[model samples]
Target chain A: MEKTARREKNIRRQVLVVDDELVNRRLLGFIVSRDYEVIYAENGIRALELIRKNERLLSLILLDLLMPEMDGYELLEILKADPALKRIPVIVLTSEKTAEVKSLQLGAADFIPKPYDMPEVILARVRRSIELAEDNIIIHETETDVLTGLYTKQFFYQYCRQHDRYCIDMKMDALVLNINRFHLVNELHGREYGNRVLMLLADNIRTLLNETNGLACRCEADSFFIYTPHRDDYGELLAEYAERFRSAIESSRISFRLGIYENVDMSIDIEQRFDRANLACTNRRSTYTSSYAVYDTQLHERELYNEKLISDMDKALEEKQFRVFYQPKYNIKGDKPVLASAEALIRWIHPELGMVSPGAFIPLFEENGLVQKLDHFVWREAAAQIKRWKDKYGRTVPVSVNVSRIDIYDAQLEEKLREIVRSNGLEPNEYLLEITESAYTDNSEQIIDKVNLLRKDGFRVEMDDFGSGYSSLNMLAALPIDALKLDMQFIRTICSSEKDLKMVELVIGIARFLNVPVIAEGVETEEQYLLLKKIGCDIIQGYYFSKPVSPEEFNKLIEAEQKEELLC
Target chain B: MLTIDSLREYGADVDDGMKRCLNNEGFYLDLVKSVIPDTRIAELEAAIADGDLDKAFETAHALKGMYSNLALTPLSAPVTEITELLRSRTQTDYSGLIDTIKKKKAELDSL
Candidate 1:
């Protein structure tokens, strides 16, 4: 990287002249200095020191055969062994008649036979060696990625074309492999661990290319493009890659999603073929069951649909087509379930399409970072509603809103939320922030710092979808949250899946120990409600109580509770 | 003043030496005269007299290169012979070769 940074224009080329005798150094230095800046080293040790200091600038080294302490041959051996310094071409300046074979064997670039070159012979050889070595170094640095040793994207595409030239009528597949949630690897583990994962994947990718007669390049961070011979089925191959990768890394948390374009259209450019592959790979997420996806017409249609939705997102927000629905959460511990805070969920009503599921657009928006806009709109709407509900019912019922992973990552999120609360004549505690557990598990320290800051500002943060994460028990105790919302998936099969029920119980126990209430969502059946109530769940929200309804529908539920309280 | 002609009179390869110095005659001649005070010739003599062939080899090796680079063939010729002899760690008398080098260097200095 230092060498890469040193590759700036207008740097004067330098040559290191290593010789014990001052006159010999001066002689070679004079000749080399005509075309390059000259550096003199008295002996092998001094030469190595200068070489290291000026490795990036030195274009050539003029080394004498014999010296005191460390000899020229010894220095040659050391330089040849080193990957960084070896590229600087060395020309042995020796009068020794028999030193030619040995010097050349030790990796001398060119030899300037001594006594004296009548005129420009030595300088000509010096220039030639420097020019050749420089050309080689430039090619090497630009050809491969420094980290993965894979072809750089430009060179990858270049090599792919050359491959076609040699093998006529060769049917190749353009495949792009991407790591899902790769940032989490860098967050959950350290950056070093993340680099190790990339290196491991690259090594396996190299082997795969070798086997399939392919070429691959690391196109971007956590993204690689591979060009290989066409295959009918990539399913088994991707599985094998997954198995090899999982065993190599020893973590299921890290997964690879590969996109493939088989029998590529020879008419299209290499980059465009890979672009389609990348599109196909990203169409489905890592959360999906399949490891690899192949590009097809149907997939292209879905991409067009998604593109349409993405294009209309800004207008939808402006026209107020997105609606905020409130689902009532009940405190189930008392004699009867008491009305508690409700969760604010977004539902979009498109002009063309009557209703779009939150599941459809939320993920799409999250992928492209438009979720923050929708989330902010919801925050403003929900805060204003809380004010209106308080004035109508004469009681302040706090509402919990989804604080997305992206929203929490925003540097000004806390200030934005505080501004919303202040403008609405409500306390920060009246608006709860629901952040997903996966967010905490990804980058605990940074998110914890952000959450602690929000809590310090009197905002109650609840960890949403708690039981679904791969969070360690140690991390659970350290979380700065007011409540834990059990992931709905766990509650959906708690009675059927014994393991799921035990996980829920374990999480609830951990939650109780932390002195925070546990909110159970997706409690649809009576049995789920009774079982959750028996297990000391503090709050419940699902169809068993009420589905996510509009504010007007939710207002009736609040009114019914008001009448009961008045009668009591 | 050591003109290139005067140095050629003492058998130094003044033309070759100047060419090696990028055709600077004054610089090449000045470098040639510097060999008179070089001290390694004397060191080679002393190290050989002390029977330290290892030190003799090192000093002779240095003088061979310096003389060869400056194109002082008279001095370099003897120095190179002694250098190879010492390199083989031969027990021969190096006084003969060392004195020849001193005599050649003194001749060039007198020029």
Candidate 2:
């Protein structure tokens, strides 16, 4: 019954009173203070000051009308004027009961006839005010994202509908900027870095908006919606803003492609506007350009093409539209081949569009968000080929497959690759996962983690396409990889250009120190192959020995190797 | 003379509605914090003090929500009322009930 009694006490109504007159304030203070948490204001000014200072503690105020300097009438006007301060129940306690109606009109809670009200009547009004305040707090929490303190998507929609805030009808230029490949950044760089980037980007956007007289809103995640009211000069403003964004991107050294659309005439709905901008980004990404594009008719066509590509890609995965071709790696130092590791390269034979080079379609697959699936398909296929090579050659020659930066962005990527290899019953040592050097430079730690995970799982990680990008040597020096694949560009020019030869010599020297094998790619001529041999390249792969062959042709090459081995 | 029953009867009609209003204001403030590039919460005070009617009204509208919720219905009206009284920068009414309400508010808090 104690608990029940406490519960009852909690529900019991309470009020708060403020007054300055020692007797008049206390008389009222005393009568109502019993049923409430009685508070005092010695004078009208003190009362206003107290209320202004601690507005939350108040439920109601029994304001006296006649007071020196700041009277009850003045306080009432002020209270009624403030929406938050106005709601506290206030009964005008004054000598003139005849002014009760006027006091009510001035927004008083109630006019208690001045002589002294029955304590019960005063208590009743105070209880009424406290009940109202409690309900308001509950409603506020539902419509917002607590962390970012932004309006939830639900509230955003309401604002859009009622205020024409984001609608085309407003003739405003609202652009939604989504951070490109943010998930990859999150996976490869770590969430803390991703969040820091977001915060910095938000600050920069705000500063830019203020400078350009534009308005920006954080819509969700890394996506921000910006609205500029100056419709007549939007084009000029956008051009100016683009430079700022470009400089910010370069300074941050983060690769991103942006989508922007300006609607001056309020010509479309929010969905269409967002869709067009997304389409523009899709087209821009397909072309591998790190530039922002405004939506146009071409964006719509690009969207359709992207949609078709995604749909076709699902079928492509199942029907084996993809095939693995092996470019043979040569053991040039021994004069004859000591080992021949196959470089796993993919070719797409689209039914309508035959012979799609990976260069032409690989980006589309990545932009259409199918790179992970492609990676999976390639992993399983390459594993099967490795199994076949072991069976035929009686030796498990390791095959290296190039994993796109997109594939490494998933934090679970190692697990996925491990699962596929385990399911295929293939030894991890027989396969190498090659990731480009540029992939690690922007997000070194994340790539390091990925490489560490793969190495722990007994797979060799090769830094592929090395020496062609800004991050190549730095990453090679930093990352824990077993091998480095020198880009064909360096190898191709080694014989023709002294600068290329010097760089190749430097790369080979570094590889020796790191104890990582260096593989020279694109060794097309006898001079290039001999130069790489003299430079101490552990492996060489190019048209000099053989072109990338189909599985059947590779099997034939393996058969020829068997005969050569017998002859040896 | 006020009684518990009388108090209940007086505020029962608008109690929930007032609470809902206050909550809505809190939510708007939260949204402003989230999306505003530089977070312009301090600017709101200057707008109210300087008698910028539009800025003051917008802020009052938000506060009115909270005031209405606490059943401090009278407190919520100042922004709207002052906004009207101060039509422009020079016309504000800085007297009487507004002051009274503030005092009563202090007394209420002490309770």
Candidate 3:
């Protein structure tokens, strides 16, 4: 029932249309309005305005070049300039066949030749474009910004070299459109409304150009860029197009600020044109925007800094700058001194910046496809730590570690784990593998098979923080897990409310029935521990025992406990 | 860099500490409260103590909320744990759980 509700909630489809001709706009709108909420503009400029207005609801764009205001080329330049809206796949519809070829070269995802074939064909293209746009949105959200839908700065730079190579080879036209004083929007109406502005801007631009040749992207928090190749002498045509684009901005109900780049020195290639426009946009500070500037030389320097950030990030892992820390887990019900089971938390000990948390770097790593390296490092580290403990303690305690969903894609997860186990001279049974419920969703059969294989080898598997994922039953039933870690939230409830206590008690009972032990996490207080004990929780770990400590500190704790026991 | 005996000692201390927490009711309650919201306490307690039908609903909702938060998830882990028990409210294991809770509380009061 819940899944069904979620699916229903996810059904909204938004489409944008940009055209210089009113007839084309109305025709496209009439055809698509039934399936998607369609927004239209007569020129690329007006499309950008609509994009800025309704960014959130937009899914696909049908762009037409040769518009009077902001010709398709200029519109594309503006769209690609902003990283946020750049993912919206454009289907360029232009009468000019030469322009269609140029549009493809300019980074247009698809080009629709002049004149619609049939309504079915148009619908098919629209459907395909929407799918691509939605996929792009998913990619953007998982790895980039949810609001602007831009390639995360980390993701953008990570892909920079390859992207630049592709651009140069294809001679793609690109532009960087920076939104001046976007901080003011965030500062004024707050982030939510500012995001709305970006959405609105992106949606409007998406609709204004020939769908095949144009794209609007959110490049940064405040900056945006669009790129498109010029097939014909669009210099004169673009001047008039810029006016319409400006007028569309002025006509919008919301009081949004604006800027533009058009009619620059046109002799250069597409990338140079984008550069010129960005330069012109930057030079004239006093002119209240809704004014257009053509390409210029200044934009090159601005791009250099981005290139450097990307390059630096690329080398971050190879430099051996990352390290890990362990947090101890305590079990409340055992009436035994809490054993330290370390959660292998990672850190980047950047040479210059001191220390960086996984919270900061992990997301960046995931975006840039560097997470695999980090995962490998973590696995090796955990294995090494466990081995060290086993050599000393003789398998009396366990070490818990995290794994990412992406690691399963490597096809060597089981092999790697086995290798690490064998290399460390450690029994797999002594180490506990902790995984999130989400990981099960990625490749359930493979994950279960591998985990079960590990279990068969005597390794203990614990589904960490079990109560918060989509498929708990499936995970428990399919995988050979030894224990289930109750998330801290379950434990928190026991202290504050009866609702939580009942729940905890129930979980304990169920686990007991299944012959699977339950570990309540985040037991911070004495009362929570008491409640967990009452509920028959097999094990409990939290701050109520002790926070994570260093090996030295942990040794001290053991000595103190022994002394106390002696006194008793 | 570390000695074998010291590592064994560390494991023993952790084991003992974990055992101590198991029999302490107040400790469990406090741990639960710290991690969950305030609004759910009264109803959850009332349901568990009295076995009210409404308590089941309230208990289920609270468990769902708490488990989701702790797990940093929105799915079935913690809530499923409780719901399974709640569904089998008449099971003998449920009684064992309640007795465990009482014993833990007694331990904490003694402390």
- Report the number of the highest-lDDT candidate: 1
Model 2 Cα lDDT, one tens digit per residue, A93-126: 6545456877888887666654344556655555
Error of 1 at A317 (Å): 36
Q: To one decimal place, how large is model 2's interface RMSD in Å?
A: 16.8
- Residues A1-568, candidate 3, lDDT per residue (tens digit)? 3643453376757788887544346545656675678878887777888887777667777887765658778777777878877776777875456787778776677866544434456767877766666666666576655665554444543444344446554333444555446677578777877676677666554554355354445656766655444333334333444454456544322332223344333345444554555566676464333334444445655455334434555466678676656666655465674554656667667666566556656666677767777777877887887676656545445677776767756677777877887898877775777877667766688888877777887878887766676665545555667887887777777677877677677667667766888887787888877767766776767677766555556555556655776787
User: Considering summed lDDT, which 10 consecutive residues are worst modelled in model 3 chain A?
Assistant: A251-260
Residue A127, model 2: lDDT of: 55
**Best-to-worst ranking by lDDT:** 1, 2, 3
Model 1 score (lDDT): 0.86
Model 1, runs deviating above 4 Å:
A1-14, A33-37, A49-60, A80-89, A104-107, A116-149, A161-173, A179-200, A210-213, A229-233, A244-269, A272-287, A291-568, B38-64, B74-106
Query: Which scores better on TM-score, 1 or 3?
Result: 1
Candidate 3's C-alpha runs over 4 A off are A1-320, A393-395, A472-475, A492-494, A561-568, B1-111
Candidate 3 lDDT (Cα, 0 to 1): 0.60
Which residue pairs collide in model 1, if any? none
Candidate 2 Cα deviation (angstroms), residue B84: 74
Q: Compare the candidates by TM-score and give the number of the best one.
A: 1
lDDT of 3 at B99: 44
What TM-score, over all chains together, does every model reach?
Answer: 0.48, 0.42, 0.40
Q: Candidate 1 chain A: worst 10 consecutive residues by lDDT?
A: A1-10
Residue by residue across B1-111, what tens digits does model 1's lDDT show? 577887788787777788789898666866776667777777888888899989988788777778887877898899889988899999987667778888888887777
Tell me the spans in candidate 2 whose CA falls farther than 4 Å from its real position.
A1-307, A472-475, B1-111
